[model samples]
Every structure is written in structure tokens, then in C-alpha cells.
Target: MEPLRTENLRPLDVSENLWDRIFTVAPLVIIGTVEGNSYDLAPKHMATPLGFGNYFGFVCTPRHCTYRNIEKSGEFTVSFPKPDQVVETSLSATPRSGCSDKATDVLQNLSVLQATTVKAPVIAGAYLYLECELFRIIEGFDDYGLITGKIRAAHVDKDYLKVSEVDEREQLMKNPLLAYIAQGRYAKISETFNFPFPKDFKK
Candidate 1:
């Protein structure tokens, strides 16, 4: 191989969030929690399955009510919104004001469904929903911490369900998944390809 371009890359500042320097594909999910007598919904991109098991984790700051609420209630619901529900997902991030829960106000406008196993609500029309109970909270990551939960129950929309008889690619093509491009961007992923791996690869 020839020599690579050394000057093409620029150094990033450590003081600021380095994530702003580049784009990353992440699953965008809405975290729902009980806030006192009311309910709260917040969209989180830095969320994922903790492992192959029935566990989920998300990054959140102490300043957010979602963290405090989950800390108190010990339960939360994760909703995987569809590509068309991006606007609804964005609305969930609405901030709260003193004596005025603007975010919950946004919730009133959206269709909300109650989870059978959890006390929190799940955003309706989402492809997937996970009802989780707080498993553990690992704090001390600067102002943010990782909140892990044990999935109590899960749900999937029928239209998006996988069928062995159906082509996976075609199934996705008909029901594209939503993706979040960090720092204010979104994508509708319909087309996909299988990853090639060495023979006898196992996870």
C-alpha cells in the first residue's frame, strides 16, 4: 500500500465532546419513566442492549429527570420508534420547566400505551418495546452514568415482525428501521446487506 495522507486528519479538543467531531450511527429509543404523579418520555441515542441476555443500558446524566425518576421507581420502558415517528421521537426530548412539564405536555399529544409488566408508558406505533426493571446503576462517568435494566417483557409490532418464510432484506425494505446520526441527524434504513465473516464464525 502507498503512504497515507498524514495532514488530512485534524486533532479534536478533549475539553469538548469529541462526538461532535464525527458522526456515529446509533439506535434512537425513547425512555419512559414515572415522574411523581405524571409520566415522562425522553429520547436517548446512547442506549443499547447490555449483552446477549435480557438486559438494556443507557447513558444519562444526573441532571435529567429520567435518571432521578428511574432511580426512584426502578423501572422504565424503552420504545423503538419507526422512521416516520422521528418527529415524535424529537418531541420527547422537550425540556421541563419549573411548575411546567413541557416534555410531558408533548406526551399528551402523542399516542401512549401502557406496558403490561411495567408501570411506565410506551410510545405507540414503535416497532419494538422493552419493559425493564432497574438492575444496577453504574455512576461516576463524569456527569453521566450507565443505567442498566433487566428486561421484564418485550413487544414487537406485527408489521415489523420477522418471519422465516419472508426474505429478511425484503421485510426490512417494507419496514425500514430508524437510525440516529449523532449531533442532529436521522436516517431511514431499508436497504441492508449481510456481513461476511470467516467460516465457522460464532458469537
Candidate 2:
């Protein structure tokens, strides 16, 4: 590889948003939280595992009900939707109106199931589900906050599970995954390639 000159690089304005200028691939999962009498499902793109353990977290704001509900209930559910359920996942982000329940309207189009460990609901038809208990909420990220949880229980659909007997590439081709391409885009990942790791690499 040849070293390139810095003259070709374009500096971006940091005062405004920088993320929208580029595309990022992220996992899209529906976070479920319990409200007063019902549940609220919100699809979060800026979510990830805290570590290699049973910990999960997502970015949220105080203005959203999902964030406040998790504060009160101390529990939440995560549902990894399949590519076919993209519409339902998108509907879960319906904004709440004045004195109206946004989840109620969206739930009409989505099917939900009770979480086994957490006092929340998981979107039905999702390939993977996780029930989590509140771990901690770290504030002070501008208007956003990190809501983390300790996974109490997890479940996965058989089709999406990997086995020693089955080839990973073939398995993935048979069951595609749903991915959120940041900047308001989504994709169904069907084909994949094995990462070329260095010899004796360890996690």
C-alpha cells in the first residue's frame, strides 16, 4: 500500500452533526419497557453489548417513554427482529402524541409476548429475545443517556442458532439478519465472509 497525502482529505464541520455524512452499519433491536398498564416498544439503532458478558445497553433520551419506563420498572426486553419483520420494527418507533399512547397504536401492528424474567414484552417473531434487569443509567451525554442492563435471560430461534454440523455461510444464507444502516437505512444481510484474523489471535 502506498502512503497517501493529507491534501485529499476533506475536513468536516464539528459544530453540526457528523454522523449523517457517513453510513454506519449497526444492529437494530426493539427495546421493550413496561408503562403504567401496558408496554412500549422502541426500535434502537445505537445499541450494543457492553462487553462479552450478559450485558446490553442502548442510547436513549429522557423525552422518550421507553427511557422513563425503564427507570420505573428497572427491567426491559430486547427483541432481535428478522429481516421480514422490518415493517414492525419501523412501526415501533412511532412518536407519542399529546395525551396519547404511541405504543398502543404501533402494537396494533406488532405482536408481543411476555418476557420470562423481566416485567416487559418481547416482540413476537423475533429470532432472538433477551430479558434484562437495570444495571445503571449514565447521564451527561448531551441530551442522550446510556441505559444499561444485566441480561437475566436469553432465547434464540432454532433456525438462527449455529451448530457444529452446519456450515456458517450456508446457515446465514438460509436465515438472513436484519441490520440498521445508520442515516435512515436498513439491510437484510444474507451473504457473509469469514474475517481474516492473524494467526493465534485471541479475543
Sequence-dependent TM-score of model 1:
0.93
Output the lDDT of residue 112, model 1: 92
Number of the top-ranking candidate, with TM-score as the measure: 2
C-alpha lDDT values of all predictions:
0.91, 0.91
Local accuracy of candidate 2 as per-residue lDDT tens digits, 1-203: 88877798988899989889988999999999888887899999999999899999999999888899999999999999999999999889887772137867877888888999777899999999999999999999899999999999999999999899999999999999999998899999999999999999999
Models 1 onward score TM values of 0.93, 0.95
* Deviation (Å) of 156 in candidate 1: 0.6
Model 2 scores a TM of 0.95
